[model samples]
Target: MTISPLETLQRVFGYESFRGDQQAIIEHVVQGGDALVLMPTGGGKSLCYQIPALVRPGTGIVISPLIALMQDQVDALLELGVRAAYLNSSQDWRTSRDVEQAFLAGELDLLYVAPERLLTDRCLDLLSQGRVSLFAIDEAHCVSQWGHDFRPEYLGLSLLHERWPHVPRLALTATATSATRREIADRLELNGAPHFVASFDRPNIRYRIIEKNEVRRQLLSFIKAEHEGDCGIVYCLSRARVEETAEFLCENGIPALPYHAGLGAAVRSANQARFLREEGVVMVATIAFGMGVNKPDVRFVAHIDLPKSVEGYYQETGRAGRDGQPATAWLAYGLQDVVQQRRMINESPGDDAFRRRLGAQLDAMLGLCETVNCRRQRLLAYFDQEIAPCGNCDTCLEPPQAWDGTVAAQKILSAVYRLWRERGQRFGAGHLIDILRGKPTDRVKQYEHENLTVYGIGADLSEQAWRGVLRQLLAQSLLAVDHEGYGTLALTDSSRDVLKGERTLMFRREPEKKARSTRSASARGKDAGIVLPPDAQQRFENLRVWRSEVARGHGVPAYVIFHDATLREIAMNPPASMDDLGGISGVGVRKLEAYGEEILRCVRE
Candidate 1:
């Protein structure tokens, strides 16, 4: 009389299997246990709750924070022929009434409600009237104030446990630090619920951080040279920056659109939808956008400004390359970014505890930006996780080179002093470099520094190396820029060390010959061969169908029994017996026992 989870998965969702741990979590929830799911962007977090909701006896309640996110999910479920609906501010009066009627009639299998909107009398009355199969919290990291992006409404969601203590619950997040993780458990009232943590590292993304100078030229060169016709998100610190940068990018022939809280709601929606649908569209935005953005093929995520924290950076960068293809996470940072952020913190009227935690998080983010170690190792270490020196980030591929700079440092300091003697210390690095290079700019002529002894003393170095020296000096606190004077170069207490050779500068080589070969045979037309083997394609589809049916019948992901590669093997060889299937990788002992006959039956049929 009762339908099993697998049968429901197949009949309702048109799938034969589950992916990853979807089935294990589904089984736990269906058996009335709480769960916490930390899956990656395209790792299929929704299905963990969605399938179990369909399998369990009563209506599943999904506590989502974003109304738009809920709408997207409900739309997706409806396409699969699932009886799912959402209650949110976006719905009209009549639609809200219809959702209510559906609930009372037991016609809806899943209902999504925003955390802030859940405690109303109407919602409580509706829930109190029926059994809740599961309480699914999407974007569960928002519950922690310590997290990079926290929402107070998410903290309020803990009352779900008090209201429906017996109902199984599952909290899901794409990103969370260890501190934030503990807060999520405490604030969500997890009552010692088991946790499912997927690896936080995204191996597919290539991380790179360029020193910020010649901002427009650097950005334009990167856009033109490497990532032409690729969809990317450029994050700025404020609405004005977002607007100006988006326009500048557009003027430079990049198809860029701006998104921030300043834009009208409809315009933002249209821009986002266009980005999700159109390839090669660039979206410039603040931190407010990109959450719940389901675009999986974003090729790059570039930050023109420093993000608030590493978690925020990771989550934003993770938005790219979700389709498992190679992607890039590019960033640019200068000293001013830190000063501005610190000033903002110093001036904030918010909670002291909040500000302190936020400041510490920012420092860690800065360290990540300036780290000389493998960027991947530094990042993974920040989360209390570990990884070997990932040979994937920009530094690992082509590390920068440096000089002792003891002599060059003395020359730079002397030039600044000589200029200060003649013209006063009111010039930026350009003026200092110009004087040192003996460039005949009118200002140099006016300053009468063409005859100075320090002039032409540093012309042996290239312009880029000079710039690198200036940046490293700024980083070392040997020199600083006067912000009010439009960043004039100024000496610091640490400059004495450079003058005495107490400190020698070390820098990375500029674009060393790297193993990263972009123009491979695949990129060229050299490998312009046939698309897919027809036999392989047909077999892959059949294996997928078989796996889907089995997974739907058993309530798991199709890939869990055997990955796509193993399926390809099955389809390619049309495996003659159990031994043949068992010989393939990923077809382990449990998988062989559970789905051997089903697979062989599909092959025979």
Candidate 2:
């Protein structure tokens, strides 16, 4: 007996209906049609292919870049009573053989393989021997060389269509610009496939970018005051920073583990496991972590360093609030970050065009950080999606003050121009700031820079304010960082217009930091956005305790057993019988048969 997609969705995954374009995409694929789907992180992209794989005749082959996450993916499916397996290098010879035999015998509903392994001739031969329902290429943006998460192995995925012309192929990603979308289609030979682009907005995430002032202390305050005892991720630009931040957090009473490529595989795997299974385990990591993490209760994603591109920032921040709960995306940015990124780009090994691409990406990221307008609006605009100002972002919450900085810009530009023209020498930001502010520092006296025409012109602004001006100037391309690795400032062609008073400049004035009120801090930490009655809250906590125990027994993440959303619903309704529990949205037939009675017992107790 064949099952309909809606029936499979309710019976197998316990969902009542499809979201956004899931129904259309699934129906297209089930009918042996190809598709390219662009959806956000928490937008149920998995179900688009998963449901079709179950409704269709043969097993589905999922080509994923996340080899580390295949086990957890299969575990989640197994909990739902779906016949799922994976082929990857992590398995032993016997395990691989068993999975292969299962595939050949049509005992599996879905199979996941890394593109690297899938491209192998042996794997191709194995797949050819089995009946394939459809091919789902996840993280399809990896096919674009310009994408943040480029995987060269994905370039060969076009052969999936050629080898199995009859099998429908569906490519999916959570992040991609229009250009990247086109690139994915071209590289994967999905041009003929229909493209479905969902809204890139994750409204549950509250975006906030703070000035880098004692960043470690700020991060500590953020976690302590807002997200204490909540799972989160802290991203750093370098491995050293990752280690230092993790140690700092641990010393200050926050449990954190460092994760980077520098760590041994076993340590990385263990830390990742703990983060997924344990509650409130903060993973301090470089970009090496978090590509395919399925943990749904992550309350925040904090970045102490600026990311390279808007796409990367959106992708990382989207990892938060995946369960539709309130989450924070906080970043600490400063002038040093700009300088460091500029230096990296200048010193990169890539050719001129490649360097320009990197520079362009960085410029867009800086614009987001510096924009006085809505952060969410500007962020979505980069992906060619437009919307009104979202009140959830920091800018909309507290609109920043924009001040006319035309004179400030001309002064800085004149400082750079005069320093180069008179002494034929360039100076870094500190020396130049000193010259502009008429500070008779040793460096200024040594260089006799106090005689410059722009000397003492910037004295009205504080040192921090002067730095902001310079940073804005750099961001606007009125100034450029020297490629000589000395971090010296130089004037750009556009600087002439600002110096000539032809272009007006407006800069966002950094707001003074106010001390967080004790009452407000306590209030934020009290519920942390999980609002329920006293009894329901107690029941929710009780269920969490039980879920933790069960997850440990099964050697899987707690969310794989049941998400917090599902458990919360059960708590709110307090199902009295097995049938009542089975009626819940996330309670599938297999799960009902496996743990329905236990859930009823927990609810009653």
Candidate 3:
């Protein structure tokens, strides 16, 4: 008996359709072909593996990196009434023993184990005992040296295939460059695997790279103006920053929470649960959160500092607007951010080659920050995916008008130089913004009537726009900020060429956007229409449990077993099984022999 991929999709997963070539990819994997999948978060990458696991004859072994991710996958499977289990540090001795027993007994359809755990002698012995159908490497890019979050343990996972040659394998990640993709293939011994590269263009995400000025003001402004009452994630570079940002947001009437490695287990879990279950809670976290979170309605992701690399930025920002609704990817960068990030890279004790690679990665991230092109197109093109203009980002939806920034750039640079010479020090952005506004208070008066030509030249432009220009200039190394003397400003090496008119500065004016709407992203056709309304979904899930039990008795994957959509259709149609099952999309020729009796038992029961 044979079944089409579409049947599995509708029946087991409960979806009536496949998302962008997912059916084709699943068919390939179901046919026991190798695959390398590159899909963004909320893009249904998991379905590619979960659907295949149901079709194959034996348990699917998923090699994942983070324990949090393992738990999330298992939890999601459990919710769908699939027989899934995970092994990680969080498990106790008896629980671990039970999982091993389940594996040997062929009672589990999907087993997720950490990469390092899979390398152990006892675990390897058990894996050797199982009738393994497929070995999936989630976060596959981590095996590549060029990847931002490389894990040496993941590189060791290639030994699985050397030991189990016939089992098909699939590798998956959210972000990968050309170099990282090749490294992943070579390291994973997937040189011959058929790779499926999905479009990396996140059209629903609005990319806004702003300069860090008054953080609290800017954040509040952006949030109030663009993302009112929407679920959001704010990333800070450190735990302290996370707490501070969260507190500030909370004080300003936004329901926000702080998450970091330093938090106790219970508190962390509670906060995470709240963010996942509760809407409009802006989670201010370090990169510690969101390993494999399935939350699909995150509306915005803001960075208080520049991410270490483009991969990190891409993955972090990808969290937003997962429901395919319009979301914002906002990053506030300044010269200090670049300096701090560079110092972090320089401080690492990696090999010279690794350091060089890290440096290049940082440059790529900076390129994204500095780019004047359509952010979506540039990001997609980086990952070898072709896409046109997004028509939804801040720039695309409301294009920023430009003016001759040459004189403005020169005046800003000149102010920095004159301030450095007179004050013999640096000051914060506030002090500088004040200086540009020709404020002759004690600070300016003490600096001697701001005795400089460019002092009052910037008065024509608003304070907000000037800060943006200066921040960007400093990040690009054209201007320097002196942190020693309270962060006074200074001109970098590039300032000379700008003043000589040998260089011209081109920049966009502020982007204009309409008000946020109440409509969902699916309504706009950006997201897959896979949502289940409140009450109908509850009844649909009850029907799924009955089908899952029947599949377990028949010793087939619940989906080979039954699809969620099939059960939904069944619940809505109340099919009486057997001949009635034939009318369902998922019950095909092969399933008739394998699961016909089970479906009869399910619907009749």
Candidates 1 and 2, the one with greater lDDT: 2
lDDT tens readout by residue for model 3, 332-404: 8765676565556656777888776776777777767766667777776667677778776645655666656
Give the top-scoring candidate (TM-score): 2
Candidate 1 local Cα displacement, residue 419, angstroms: 13
Q: Extract clashing residue pairs from model 2.
A: none
Off by over 4 Å in 2: 518-527
On lDDT, the stronger of 1 and 3 is: 1
Off by over 4 Å in 3: 1-6, 30-32, 208-214, 217-230, 251-253, 325-373, 412-463, 480-496, 511-605
Per-residue C-alpha lDDT of model 1 across residues 489-541, encoded as one tens digit per residue: 76778787877778776654446433433422111211111134787767677
Cα displacement (Å) at residue 410, model 1: 8.3
C-alpha lDDT of candidate 3 relative to the true structure: 0.74
Candidate 2, 401: how far from true, in Å?
A: 0.4
Compose the digit string of candidate 2's lDDT tens values, residues 1-605.
99999999999988888888899999999999999999998889999999999999889999988767788889999999999999998889999999999999999999999999999999999999999999999989889999898888999999988999999999999999999989999998988989999999998899999888789999999888788888999999999999999999999999999999999989998999999988889999998799878888888999999999999999999889888878889999988889889999999997999999999999999999999999999999999999999999889988999999998888888888888898899988988888888899998888777777888988998889988998888887788899999999898888888889899999999776767544232124423566888899888988888888998999999999999899989989999888788789899999999988888888888
Q: Give per-model TM-scores.
A: 0.75, 0.98, 0.77
